[model samples]
Target chain A: MATNRQIVLDNRPDGEATTSNFKLVTSETPALADGQVLVRHHYLSLDPYMRGRMNESKSYAASQALGEVMIGGTVGEVVESRSPKFKPGDQVVGMGGWQEYSVVDADAPGMLRKVDTTHVPLSYYLGAVGMPGVTAWYGLVKIINPKPGSTVVVSAASGAVGSTYAALAKARGCRVVGIAGGPEKCRYAVEELHFDACIDYRVHGDVKSMSKALKEACPDGIDGYFENVGGYILDAVLLRTNAFARIAVCGMIAGYDGAPLPLQNPTLILINRLTIEGFIVSEHVEVWPEALKELGTLVAQGKLKPRESVAQGLQAAPEAFLGLLKGKNFGKQLVKLI
Target chain B: MATNRQIVLDNRPDGEATTSNFKLVTSETPALADGQVLVRHHYLSLDPYMRGRMNESKSYAASQALGEVMIGGTVGEVVESRSPKFKPGDQVVGMGGWQEYSVVDADAPGMLRKVDTTHVPLSYYLGAVGMPGVTAWYGLVKIINPKPGSTVVVSAASGAVGSTYAALAKARGCRVVGIAGGPEKCRYAVEELHFDACIDYRVHGDVKSMSKALKEACPDGIDGYFENVGGYILDAVLLRTNAFARIAVCGMIAGYDGAPLPLQNPTLILINRLTIEGFIVSEHVEVWPEALKELGTLVAQGKLKPRESVAQGLQAAPEAFLGLLKGKNFGKQLVKLI
Candidate 1:
């Protein structure tokens, strides 16, 4: 048996989430049952989706229960195994939550996966080759379905999903543009991520200004868009869309707080003959294999690079998550548990 | 040569369209060139799309040029013909505009189609078996693509497109519900159009009230929707949409008058995983033959019934179109010139 330290949901958010809503707690990991594996999590991923679970309202996923370990993705090493599928030294990825250790039913299909880290690093399974990577793939390939030589844009362009999306679009012969919070991230998106251009949303905060920048960045007009931030950026993108443009909506982090995020002049949908679809990556598991293959290959070839903003220890998870929501995190946000 | 009375766009609307923006004038139908036919219009179809054309802004089609004959669909009889393909007294449907007569290039493919009215009324060609009917077909069959036993909803359910959609969905073995302006139109939708239930927006004008009504009407939740009117209706439907619901947006007449029709809670798109697509039926001419065949068969079988609110003479075009925009017309709004 081992003592496990974790963060739990203390209460639902009133409007916007704060660090006070989370509570750090201690528990003992019980002896493993048959078909169970004891995992020691080295890193816990902090994603934007966790914010939706904190709300009491009905959302795509079930609400996070109070006094429970906060739901999250984790990469770890198996310390002990009662399941035939795993061994003590196996490096694994699973939903290990906010706890330092997890007793997983490894035999429960898809509950845990053993990943090869000879060429790709272990933590990248949490960002570039995991859920975030597959998300960018589905929205770009299945939803946006851009043609070669077309222009495609992604919001939160320097973050996990957007960075991956920009790279994927560029690889597909598209003129990839990005929308990020500030100049530093914009520079990273264009310079490092190989985006044709990136617009700084902080300077062009409103729809009119953002539309002007988008017009300049996408001189041919935006043909497809992967939406992660959905307030003024969405309105601006809608205004600049070419005829028959498609939008794949992955997240609306701006609306995670209770304030209404209204789309100004939705009449543009008709004017532009647009198609806008929303999706959750978890629901579409069929494409994960194909997506992960592409992502893993790119990372191995040094074509797709990864960046992370990691907080130290489990207790820093809440602050790191809050920072992620506020655009303080530069890329994938995570908590180092070791 | 023949005297032809016509309505022309005199000016564009500043905020809301008014009758003063259109002018009535008389013209002489010029002598037909080779491969041309002169038609005497029986009925001119006044549709919501015309309101969009009156604006100077870029849209699916070009703006209705100032001092030119207002664009419209018409059912008429050939009065004179220089083309071998058409003869005098042949019934036809074409873009005859808001005039008593038109000189069309008969040899031009798709410009003029000779339609048989042996089992169908001549005026029905401008409605149930024409552009509006084909429009309803494409949105439901191609976009929404609902399954049997799924619940589909449509707004403006007593109008030309909505009524046809209600009939088509009912035929497809789906639970069909509708929303219209008043109790009378709602009654017509449910009783005459065979809708399972109908909501009256006059009573449920706001999002909260409309949402409650939709919950009761669509107990299984809305699986698909044909969005003709946008505003509170769009907001209410978004709240009640089932996961993976599809919305085929044909028009947003409520926003046509230059007022901002902001979509409240666009975040619901992500929450519900909805797909909303906008289209102009004229753009997809490829589907017309298949759509028209099905619509024609249903109408001839007495399964599809058509209702109209037609104004008399070319002079009434402006007033009738304005009335159609205000939900004053019960069904298909048309101007009868004969």
Candidate 2:
């Protein structure tokens, strides 16, 4: 018998999640069935969207039931294989949950992807070269559809998705303005991401001033808006949006918790002919290969940089997720389980 | 010398506009300029957008200067033509302002469209066949983009734009539900406009309950929302929108006053993948002729009906406009200046 550690959802959270929400215990694993692979988990991705799954309410994705092992994307080494295609010591990325070892059918949809760590770190598979990076890329290029000389505004510009969008938009010849919560992230957005301007919403009194600052920075009013933090930021952007503007509605971290927040002003939509659209990254999986190839080259060419704040143990996953929600993480927060 | 009675802005109101904000003044007509036609205002159109123009602050259109004649759209007779294109006794429509007579240039855009009282009343130009009418048509067909059998919802269903959109969507094989303030309007929306169902938001007490009622009426969830009165109604609709839903944002009658209101909840936008677009009819002048032709044919076939509340005289324009802002006037509010 093989023994491995697993993290299960002990209880659903009331408001903000705490360490008590998760329970870590040892579990016995049986022999793998035909075409099955027993993998040793090495890294786990800690993300904001996972917080939504922890709740028992409705979300874009399915709910993580109470008492089940917490679901997560992981990169691991295959210790045992029952299929001809895989042998021992094969490295792959899969949804292995929060477990030291998992038995998965090799033929399962999205079972695994063979990763080459020579060019990038293994954790890169859980961040920049994976879900978050492509989310920013596909959202900006395909949804917002910015043209050269277009004024682009992005929120949470130091985070994984927003940083990717800012760098890509800059390379595409667009003038990018970013909005973040603190001065440190604001400085990082401007200095490292090469954004034309950055506004610290925490310091700014209101969105109207932010709009004036954005207008001053870009000269041309916002033509494309990559929304990450919704609420006042969205309302202010609505006022400054030019005619025929496109808004890629990405994330609304401001309203994710179960509080009843106020809504955005609606009249701006009529004054400026604006189109706001929302989408999920997984919905565009078929086109991932092309997006990944382009993003990889950009990374290799030093045009795009992947920033990560790696927490060096599975026990730190809760803190990592908490830090991510509070915007305390420097960049893409990840947990290393190896 | 011809004498004209006009409504002038007495003073800008602080919040809800009062009768004291306007004054009826008798003035002598000025001589017409070259290539200009002197129009005797026959049918003055009173619209909700005029309330926005009354403010001293800048809007999509210029604000009404102090003591200036209130701006409005009207159908009139070309009693005195200084140009060869128009002649005396010719009935035309133009921006005649809120007066009995005005000198208009022959070449002004939306300058005039001749009306025949035989098929549809000249007031139809103020209601179903004019700006408000086209607003509904374009919002439903062009912006909302509803598919056959899709669920559609409209706010202020007794109002010109809302009623027209509901009627048109019903004609296109959609399951239409309308939100109105009173039972009378709700009854009319279902019994007359042929909508599948209607919700009286005022009677519901809370938007959540109304949203539940709306969802029950629309078992499949909302695919299209024609937003006329934004605020709680919009927030409720945001909660119930199906994936890939489209919102045609026309006006937020609830926010017409200068008071601060609650912002829209944006997280619903991301979870449902909603597309909310704000548009004005003037932006699509090139396509107006096509839309008008199709809408006129529908009216001629009795598949569409135009509704109007005709005020008796030019001096009554101020009261009519006030009535429109208060939702007192049913259907399209118009002043028959003839």
**Tens digit per residue, CA lDDT, model 2, B222-248:** 999998877777888888899889998
DockQ of 2: 0.53
Scoring each candidate complex against the real one, what DockQ results?
0.82, 0.53
Best by lDDT: 1
lDDT of 1: 0.93
- Candidate 1, B1-338: lDDT as tens digits: 89998888899988789999998898899999999999999999999999889889886568989989899999999999999999999999999998999999987788999999988888888888999999999999999998999999999899999899988999999999999988899888988999999999999979999999999999999999999999999999999999999999999998887887999999989999999999999999999999999998999999899689989988998999999998899888888899
Interface RMSD of each: 0.9, 1.9
C-alpha lDDT (0 to 100) for residue B328 of candidate 2: 79
Measured against the true structure, the TM-scores of the candidates, in listed sequence, are 0.98, 0.92
Q: Which lDDT tens digits does candidate 1 get at residues A1-338? A: 78999899999999989999999999899999999999999999999999999998897688999999999999999999999999999999999999999999987878899999998889999998998999999999999999999999999999999888987998899999999988899999888999999999989988899999999999999999999988989999999999999999999999998887999988888899999999999999899999999999999999899689899999999999999999999888889999
Model 2: residue B120 alpha-carbon error in angstroms: 3.5
RMSD (Å) per prediction: 1.2, 2.7
